[model samples]
Target: MKQRVVPIAVLAGALFAVNVVARLITRFGFDGDDTAQYRITIGMFATIGVILASVAYVRAQKSLPSEWLPSLAAAAIGGMLLTILVGPFLSGGYPFSAGAGNFFSQIWLYGGFAIVGILFGYWIATMLGRDYRSQSLKAFTAAKAGKPRRVVRR
Candidate 1:
């Protein structure tokens, strides 16, 4: 449990760093316009989706949710925090300005998008049945190539 938590925390931190970098880039690299900021946010989410899908394709189904969900949830939380805390500092704008809604809205927006991405990845992997095929092939090979089968003693 301790070992697992450590790695998850580290991965979540990495995800948070990605979000921070994206936010910083959008804040400084482009015009301080709402549309540009929104576009950058969208691109960041899309990148996350692609990454999750790739991970799902490579990861085994049995361990998919367990291994990824904690880190993902942590990342979502950390990402939201990064956006809220650093948004104003880097963008020279308040997180919830007069035009924007409450701060919690940011949390919902980021969480919803992250969850959707993760679910989409998991669904695609499951629909492809790669895990099942891999296990089946392994069983078949083991049974066929291993030593002769011994008769069962009732």
Candidate 2:
């Protein structure tokens, strides 16, 4: 349990770190530049997507989705909450100081990016026949090949 908790915490911290970097860049380097800020936001989200996708792809190869997915989900949620609520303060702003529209849009973007990343990762794993389910199926078939099936009684 401690082992599992550690990885999830690390992933969540990583996500928050990404958010912090983006906020810092926006606050200092791109201040008063909406275009630059927008670009930074997009870049940050893309990075988040890639991070999650990588985690998904790697995890899918090692364990069943049921076993590992909750960890990933928890990490994402934890990261999102931290990024949304605590992140603004780092830039000397309130979470919703950007206005209600921007606050909600950020939520939408976070959820959208996270889902797409997970799907993309799982899709690639499935296509490569490296996901746990695919590997399990292959192993099952291989093992059954040497065994004779018992006839079912009516």
Candidate 3:
């Protein structure tokens, strides 16, 4: 349990850190500029996608998607919750001051990006024939092909 939780927490923390940095930049650097805020948000999402994709690639090499995907989702959700709830306070603003629509939009965006990232990573691993299941199937096929056939006695 610790092993699973620790890594997920670390992933979540790293993601939260990215969010904090983006939020800080938007708050301090951009001030009233919506354009810079939008750009920063987009970049933040892209960074999250890349991070998740990298994690998926690494996990695919050793474990089935079923084993690691839930962890990835949990990490994303945890980080997003922290970013949306706690982050605003840190930035001297209310969490839902932007209204419910914007709040929900954030959730949707984060979830969508996470799913896409994981899929992208897993797809690349499969294409490379390096994923756990792919490697297993390849080994099975190779072993079967290498086996000698027994002759039937008349």
Candidate 2 lDDT, tens digit per residue, 65-119? 8998899999998899999999999999999998999998998899889889988
* TM-score, predicted candidate 3 vs. hidden true structure: 0.94
Sort order, lDDT high to low: 2, 3, 1
Q: lDDT per model, in order?
A: 0.66, 0.93, 0.90
Clashing pairs in 1: none
Per-residue alpha-carbon lDDT of model 3 for 1-154, expressed as tens digits?
8988999999999999999999999889998999989889889988998999999999998999899999999998999899889888867888898898988888888888888998999999999999999999999999999999989999
Query: Hey, what RMSD does candidate 1 come out at?
Result: 4.0
Q: What is the TM-score of each candidate against the true structure?
A: 0.67, 0.90, 0.94
Between candidates 1 and 3, the lDDT winner: 3
**Which pairs clash in the backbone of model 3?**
none
Q: What does candidate 1's lDDT look like per residue over 1-154, in tens digits?
A: 7866775566556656667778689866876587887888778767765655555555546554676666656655665576666655656667666345646766666667767777777777677766545567768998898878779998
Window of ten residues with lowest summed lDDT in model 1: 55-64
